[model samples]
Target: MKLKSGCFLQHLHLLLKYTACMSVRNAAALMEHFQLLDVHRKNYLNDLQFYCFLCYVTDLNKDKIMLLFDLLDRNVRGRICFNEFYTVVYTLLSHENDLEKQFIPRHAGRAFQLLDVDRDNMIDFNEFEAKRFLFNIQKEVKKIFKDIGISGDEQLNYREFKIFAVFCIDKQQKEEGDHE
Candidate 1:
């Protein structure tokens, strides 16, 4: 089903209602309930692992991820079920400090505008798939690499990429902290 940005945000709000109660296993089961287990299988696995690593590095536990999933899901339908999941993850993966400034609804709107190549005001589920999003992310990564004296040949392996993602999030948080 197609979703407008506002509708997606509402879904996240709805999901948040359950965050205080559900366990991680229960959350995973909820995902299964929505038939999202196989949605972009390889990417889902990678994202799950990456998310787990983020939680580990941040000293958060599975319960926190469950909270985050519920908080971000908005609709509480069990699955991410919308492109907004990308926005939520991007926000979560961003630095905590910059999260408010950079990933807030207003900023997210701008990000969406920039990414919506056709100006359709919505990102299709296909476009929201992790692989496709990673392709777009790679373009941004290339720019960052150039700034850091890293080359395309210095590609990040999976483990490295996970770390780098966390690092970037931390960096953004630091920048945000500095601003405050």
Candidate 2:
């Protein structure tokens, strides 16, 4: 579970390229769409296929897609695993959803760049606490943050956010009931 400094920094560098997102449900829909592509028989999103996928999933311009290709295409092998694809899509979708909800949607991405003060791509309790006042649904966002933190260390990593999003459906349903 521990990452070497070099690897950690490498990921940190890639994170700086982020700035937008969609919704978890849309992310799932994207996953399903990818699965049905019948392309990338090897289950890898390569340079050529990656472009096609991006075009299919979003209206992001070529330059931006190239930027994302650099970040999401880990290993520089000109390809991305499902996990990587999901990460990129989820990150974008999360941001998109937040925008729709008017929550951290303006700063770009699901979590917002402002939260990662240290620019390490992860949000610790301190960062979350510092920006707590920025969110409309403070309690809900905080609870989601806690639920997304799987390390038990109060740090919400990119991967954990994916898990958190998967369960947010229930949270939405609950919120609807409360509102009613």
TM-score of each: 0.29, 0.40
Q: 74-124, model 2: which lDDT tens digit per residue?
A: 456887777767655544444333422332333235454445666687778
Taken over the whole model, the C-alpha lDDT of each candidate is: 0.39, 0.53
For model 1, the local distance difference test gives 0.39
Displacement of the residue 168 alpha carbon in candidate 1, Å: 0.7
Off by over 4 Å in 1: 1-152
Q: For each candidate in turn, give its C-alpha RMSD to the true structure in angstroms.
A: 15.2, 14.4
> Considering only N, C-alpha and C atoms within 3 Å, which residue pairs clash in candidate 2?
21-92, 21-93, 21-96, 22-92, 22-93, 23-93
Off by over 4 Å in 2: 1-30, 99-180
Residue 31, candidate 2: Cα error in Å is 3.8
TM-score of 2: 0.40
Q: How many clashes would you count in candidate 2? A: 6
lDDT for model 2, please: 0.53
Cα lDDT tens digits, model 1, 81-173, are: 424444443443332222333233334443443333444544433332322232223223444433332334444333333344445445655
Which consecutive 10 residues in model 1 have the weakest lDDT in total?
Answer: 8-17
